[model samples]
Target: MTTDRAMRDTDRMERPAPPAPEPLPRPVLDSHVHLDIVGSDGAGASPEAQVEAARAVGVDRLVQVGIDVESSRWGITVAEKNPAVVATVALHPNDGPRLADLDAALAEISAMAEHERCRGIGETGLDFFRTTGPAELAAQERSFRAHIAIAKRVGKPLVIHDRDAHADVLRVLDDEGAPETVVLHCFSGDADFAAECVRRGYVLSFAGTVTFKNAVGLREAARLTPLTQLLVETDAPFLTPTPHRGAPNASYLIPLTMRALAEVKEVPLADLCDAISATGDRVFGPWP
Candidate 1:
């Protein structure tokens, strides 16, 4: 008979989250994560348990991001009940082509944006890697522009998910006039892309992928970014950091990424944590 951890492993969840790392010297937010997905994926922790675990490690806040209408609604509800969580609402670009009524779907997303617990609009923008053909790509562009409008109208930050489509993402933002605040969630751009984002003053949120030994470009991007323009996330249950890459990830594992980032930027660990903490408050506003 298999042990419980082994049994859960057979179900395809990433492995159980690693032991809690030492707490950070200063608190900072996991700028993006999918707590609902973590719970559903047999991550061996409830949402409340995840939050408590994160808090115990100095990750005092989180921004639960939604990729579709259902997940968006769940994020908002989670935020409402958890003081440590704030929600970001959006329809994932790849999900754009599947919607029977794109406009109606967007309308619901827009309405959700009005909730006080919802602090950002995104995990949106574009994904050229997964999308092919004009019709599907067109749907993503339309949804991206619409999400930008919602973010601007609500005066909240626009969280972008740019994957292999840096140029198009910037063009659309330029054409639509980006919201007052914008973030590139799990920023996957190169040094040149990082320069442009820096010039435009958008925050760059790095994930655990930065800790991968072969992620030279990502580490370089981190080095180029100023502390003020930087944020950290696990994008957990997904991009678990090195030494724990194959394991399930949670906010409690943030210190591992934080330390990696500090090394890349050549800054003291405590100082970098403080800067990221302050930037979190700046971009997402005070958590309620």
Candidate 2:
């Protein structure tokens, strides 16, 4: 099924999340994930289970990303209740076009963004692949620009969701001027695009996709990125890492992605964890 459909499809949730892999040498943070989505999906893992399971396997910190008003509020509630979790609020590019009153919705997003538990503004940016019409694309851009402005005003990291629209994403960021801390979550770019982002000092957060054998370019991007600008995630209930590719994904499985990243970066796992932890602090501020 298409990712757009899957994100909205609760009925066809994948099988339960897989068993956890061996713990990492040191702890690291999941830079982006959807615990709300995971809880609804087949995994049916509670927030407590998801956080503790990841912590057990050295993924102690979690960032629950929001894609709409309802989810954004849910993320704030989740973050308030879980010390291990922080949240980011935004209108997903796909959802932006579907909103009835986008401005009113954004106003709520802006208000939620100021909460102490909310660490950033995004999972925003552009997506050309799913958006076929000019009107939808225009709405996405309008929402993206508004999200960027909100992030800047709030002085929070802008966690971006860029898919198949790298150049335009960069164009808009350049036009609006980016926040001090910008994260390309679930980064889906080639080495060249990665290089451009790196030059601008944006954090490139990788998901389980980098573990795919066919993701040669993504691996190269990982290799090219300095550890200080790098982050990892499961984007759980979606990009399940290798060895457990078909099953549902959760924060507990971060080691699979972290291990793959360590191999690609050719660094000791402990060293990688150290770098990720430091960068996580820089990007999200230490989790409450």
Candidate 3:
């Protein structure tokens, strides 16, 4: 898959700016976001401003997810300074082949996992879509296993990035004995797949993509996810929700996606917000 940053760059020229939605009835945390990349959208605010904007709209907390070693360290730094942010570290599956030493990269990620602000090990998992070559796929799998071990060893939640490889992701997790806490970040699956994830007790994190008009399958998955296993995120700088599909995304835009999710689950907006907030605390531990 194309990098989130690249997509955002293209989107900047093609789409109109998104108007902010009404603030949520209660606070909800964005379980996965790229605050670093989101800041690059020329029209976007600084990371500090982004955080403040999110807070003003009832998005009081966020999980800053890293896609590589440099970004992982940056995420930790951001988390250290922001009480509302927690970090998750890992090399993205799509980045495996580009790394000169996957083991060394994993080692750094492991060390980062021990940080107090780093509450999860993730953005790691299979991506059959982008990695079609056998060697690249092998490297991706190796990196994934290493991340799983690190998460289990450190006793932190394991955040997964399953993109067009849901079955393989589950197979690998089952083979390696998944960490106690597993989250399917930006969950991309159908109702049946959602059942599989639910059976394994993995949390399903919905992003702006779920609100797209063509995301019927995603909507089904959202509806199928239990209240306790549900989480919401912006996946900022990418996958901006409908009415803002082509615009640059940020944590502040989460209320639009959350409202869309509430509609899909047929739950009251305030109740869904409460559930998502509580689930965030449960999945990643209480926000510090």
Q: How high is the lDDT of residue 67 in model 1?
A: 84
Collision pairs in model 1: none
Residue by residue across 1-288, what tens digits does model 3's lDDT show?
126443346645345556667999999998998888774442355678878888888999999999999999999999999899999999998888778988888889999999999999989998887676899989999989999999999999998988888889988998999999999989989999999999889999999989899899999999989999999988877778888777778888999999899999999999999998998998776776
Off by over 4 Å in 2: 1-12, 39-44
* Runs in model 3 lying further than 4 Å from the true structure: 1-8, 13-16, 40-43
lDDT of 1 by residue, 1-288 (tens): 001111234333634547778889988889998887664433345778888888988899999998889989999998889899999999988888878999999999999999999999998998887677999999999999999999999999999988889999999999999998999989888888999999999999999999999999999999999999999998876677898887777788899999999999999999998999999999996986
Best of the two (1, 2) by lDDT = 2
Instruction: Select the stronger candidate by TM-score from 1 and 2.
Output: 2
